[model samples]
Target: MQYGAQRVSDINLSQVRKMFEQASPTAINLALGEPDFDTPKHIIDALKNALDEGYTHYSQNKGEVKLRETIVDKLKKDNNINTTADNVILTVGASEALYSTVNALIDPKDDVLIPDPGFLSYREVVKIAGANPVALKTSAENGFNTTLDDVENTVTENTKAMIINSPANPTGSVMPKDEIKAIAEFADENDIIIISDEIYEKIIYDKKHYSFQAYTDNAVTINGFSKAYAMTGLRVGYLSACSEIIDEVLKVHQYNVACIDTATQIAATEALTGPQQCVSDMTSEFRKRRDLVVDSLYDMGVECIRPDGAFYVFFKQDNPDEFIQKALKEDVVLVNGNAFGEMGEGYIRLSYAQSYENLQTAMERLAKIA
Candidate 1:
């Protein structure tokens, strides 16, 4: 079958994502990486207030002035990086930010370096943008942190960018300051764009999250209110890059969806500037679940990285595909790590986004299978 573009072959992760949506008793999804919390009442109220005030209209393609300013303030206060509002581009969510950036940077033949056990979206986004996705292997033995040695082996002249996620998805590993600095320096020297997805920045267990933007001048910092503020439905995420890169991405943005909703922009501003207690509370709860899962996995003789951040556990099994098949029969569904990329083989990514009771029950079910 002929398609308009080769990239059309790209598919969403819906095959595994739909495991829970289908409501199979044989499926207990710890697959999707979504915040289980309800959107804070105050943030919801802010949207209602915007509706009452007739804030509905086509917003600026780059987003509203106030929201951009709020995002700028957030970057300075939280990440300790000074960024101007003009350098930021608001997209539907981090997903769109990632797509837009990859599209803007790559030609049909370009290659993008990605972490092995990364967010499932990275490769799909790269392929959809008409680029080749190259997996740079990072292992559980190495704490799933990307080393300069691993990346140096992967980079070539055709490499256009590198996608980095810390407080990373699936693995839940947070790269330290020294490693981030080394990667940033490498990107700078190689003239490759670094797309840092910091969406899970706030869900850390013990250590503070580090933004790659803090270490380099050549990286794009991708963030959103979805994970941190429990505003997943709002679909408001923004990217902070150099003005040159931001301009090119906005060109792609204007052609494909035009812009985000005005009311969501207003609500997002309130999320950044208003009370932050919700984020703190959510992080505390996630930590508790992380502890429970980590302890349980250890007891089961399943080796997992001691995740410093994020609500996930990337645990190894003797044979991941076989174990996942058996686990589904045991009525505790999880994503086979190989679904993310080839380097993700022999692993299973279990999201701790469910309640403690559900996690405990799921663990017990897996134990029975063991």
Candidate 2:
């Protein structure tokens, strides 16, 4: 008897996790995109205080009122998105927010536009929702930003939604403000709902993040404290949209995860309302690491675009599979670009979220093969 559903069987484990698990014990990991920083003292203290103050119980299904209110202000001030707590749903993480939004809005056989060589979850989530994920292929020559032409060429009458990620995963490319507004306008005109992933917004260097909802009312914005606050384990994230959309997504959130826990919500509220120096410091350090990786690759005559944000460098190679094998042999683990999507072939993504000393050593090791 078949035990698993066809959708479950169709999806394989992500290659990013596969490589990380299979790498040699001695290998320097540049595979996962997780930040190496510890959660800030203030946030940690808030969590402790919340637990001590009896905040261990279940929160509102949507989330704590304070955190939701803080997120509303954040959206207005930082993202230029005007929203209310009633239009927000706190989620398990950006992962759940993405999953819930896709499942709630996308119908079976509907087409969803996703960037090729984009976040791996975007395609998988759409597939899990029984939707067709149309690839909007981006190339290194174009700085890996999804363009108006790409959307125009690929979108069809069946296209119901699109996902856009700035300071994108694997490639670390950020979309320009003018381009963002243009795409948002086109999506609005075409009646395609935009799902904007801004998980990496605060990690950016020298680039500004433009929220899709800022330009269009028909949009869902997903963000979290994971990357920015190094709170991956806390599992706190949120989604904001018009009440019509949020109302539906809340149904999914209620069933999947009733609440994100009061302690974490209190801590997340602190993460937003407390001192922001921690965020600035982390971003400053990431910028230095990014430069080190880019310079090392350049010195080796490797081909790559200097990323404007995020902590990854997706460099081109002639034989990415063989290159990955050689890199593993050199005790420096890297992910093959094909893991992201078909357009990612012939590339390898290197994460620079490790210590400067470790990155220095990894660069030395990669130099031998480059």
Which candidate wins on TM-score?
2
Off by over 4 Å in 1: 1-4, 10-15, 21-27
Q: Which residue pairs clash in candidate 2?
A: none
Candidate whose lDDT is highest? 2
Residue pairs whose backbone atoms clash in candidate 1: none
lDDT of 2 by residue, 1-370 (tens): 9998887677767889999998888889999999999999999999999999999888899998889999999999999999899899999989999999999999997999998999999999999998899998998889999889889998999999999899799789999888889988998898899999999999898888888899999899999999999999998999999999998998888898888878999999999999999999999999999999999999999999999888899999999988888989999989999988999999999999999999999999999999
TM-score for candidate 2, please give it. 0.99
Model 2, runs deviating above 4 Å: none
Candidate 1's clash total is 0
| lDDT, each prediction | 0.85, 0.92
lDDT of 1 by residue, 35-69 (tens): 88999988999999999999999988999999998
